[model samples]
Target: MSYPRLAGKRILVTEADAFMGPMLCQVLARHGAEVIADAGTLADDPQRPAAIVAAAGTIDVLVANLAIPAPSTPAVEVSEAEWRATFAALVDPLPRLVGAVLPQMLARRSGKILLMGSASALRGMRRASTYSAARGAQLAYIQAVGVEVAPYNVQVNAIAQNFVDNPTYFPPEVQADPRFQDRLRREVPLGRLVTAGEDAEFAAFLASDAADHFVGQVFPVCGGWVGR
Candidate 1:
């Protein structure tokens, strides 16, 4: 399916080598978007997000494709360092990126910010306290900022997803495990993982003009893992 909607649009996708980044870049490019894939990490400096925005020049959309390997430490065992590290990887860069791009979008009264978030934020999972907290923070921030930027014609939204076929989260070795396959059947109502291309296509729609009516929305793309 050709998404002519994104054609000619300039989009910057951060963490472009990880998570859903490469698939998203490919899908958006296939849809005719001028995609700038940034594989840099936003650690070591608070100003990195702004630098990234500046490096992308003018953009019609920003896909915050942020992620980190989830730690399985028990809630009682989670350390402050772990908590901070999780947030640093997933939460801290959001506002900085928005701040950097807001001026340009607000001036033109048009832009889109689509977060490639996690469904783990929307639902509780054992041994994921720190990771869940950081992901939750991301969605909350998007809700607050989405409404704030809406009147200016800037859309901010998120796809809180899980059980999707992606290298970062669900690699071949894990998928081949019988234990993992059983968990997929029992836990996911759809009984299978959603494809990466499918998830990226949803991102494309959110970044397109067709999604202008949407703002401050957290759409779960986890195949009934986190039911509305």
Candidate 2:
């Protein structure tokens, strides 16, 4: 007996120990989605039970929300080695994770991939060269992959956001500084930071049957920050 609202849907979330990761998993699970806690990536553990897609069986949905810091202190001050490491950490593992289940999704002709991106990537930032570069590249990847899998009924899309209260992935320095908050309030028309559950809610919708028409879409949930 499958539940219509997401009873048997298998959802795999990365960075599970982080604020949004675990929180989204629980929310999805409560909504009837069969949530798979893919927390191994956070530990850098290459051998967790659900470390790879094959191990977790056919995943109905995959949410990749991993983040890494740039090696260089500033864009100008950052070294080549640090840049490479930053991209390596930010981009390299995705193929490994998605590659494992993408084939199966193609075979099944239905699946969804949600990426947690940032608004800075949509519009470049001054000090976030490394991070924004990686995120921009990720957005491009989402577009390409979305088109590639569209024929198979697989949707690949990204959610570009500015501020979510979820602090697990937030850099400590930024949290402590009020200047960033002021700027955020000024730039963001909503006048408040984004909420984690809102993101999870949108993700749930994208993963559901209702979002069949969505593909190659970089949905910006940035509270009007990037729209202007």
Candidate 3:
């Protein structure tokens, strides 16, 4: 845990206040990275991603930790507005962030892009149609871009997670619910949510030079929920 695996690296973490952002910044910094924690919204402004990248000059890693409250509307009841908003919040900023930071990374022939995605995309979930669709789009984009940039040594990958402890999704009230506990035991093979630190530690590994060989991979951090 004390190893300086990310020593002297400059990392830019987006939406640093939400999702896995806080824990990720803390863990990456603990690993000796100079983390640029940006707690900004990229959904409202299309240009914000570029601005964030421009502001965080010379980034060795980009942690795209974008998130929003998942809409639980049934598939047939999912409105166009809900769909658009979901995509805007979860999927749209990806290319913009990449476009802003990738040229520099490619020029240096080095850099890592780690997306904090969702496991709902990899498995079916009732009342999660909009959220899953957008998340799936994100993973697809990462896969395509990851391969395209891998030859240039710019690795792009994602962590598809669910049943992971985070305020954005599984807050205190939800965790304390008996129904939720029963569901957790019934569905997740691990029998509990994956801790935030565990998830963040894995993310740090992915962002480190140690993970340079991985390309376009979607690592699931869902406590075996996807398997069950």
Structural similarity to truth (TM-score) of each candidate:
0.97, 0.86, 0.98
Over 4 Å off, model 2: 1-4, 40-51, 69-72, 169-177, 226-228
- Which rank order by lDDT, best down to worst? 3, 1, 2
lDDT for position 133 in model 2? 81
Over all chains combined, what TM-score does candidate 2 have?
Answer: 0.86
Q: Which lDDT tens digits does candidate 1 get at residues 1-228?
A: 784778889999998999999999999999989999999677557988999899888989999999888999999999999998889889998889989988999999999999999988887799999999899999999999999999999999999999999988899999999999998888889899999999999999889988999999999998786243
CA lDDT, every model vs. true structure? 0.91, 0.74, 0.94
Ranking by TM-score: 3, 1, 2
Supply the global lDDT for candidate 2: 0.74
Q: At residue 101, give the lDDT of candidate 2.
A: 70
Write model 3 residue lDDT over 33-134, tens digit each, in one string.
999999967999999999989988999999999999999998999999999998999999999999999999999999999999999899888899999999
* lDDT at residue 91 of model 3 (Cα atoms): 92
Q: For every candidate structure, what is the RMSD over all alpha carbons to the true structure, in angstroms? A: 1.4, 3.4, 1.0
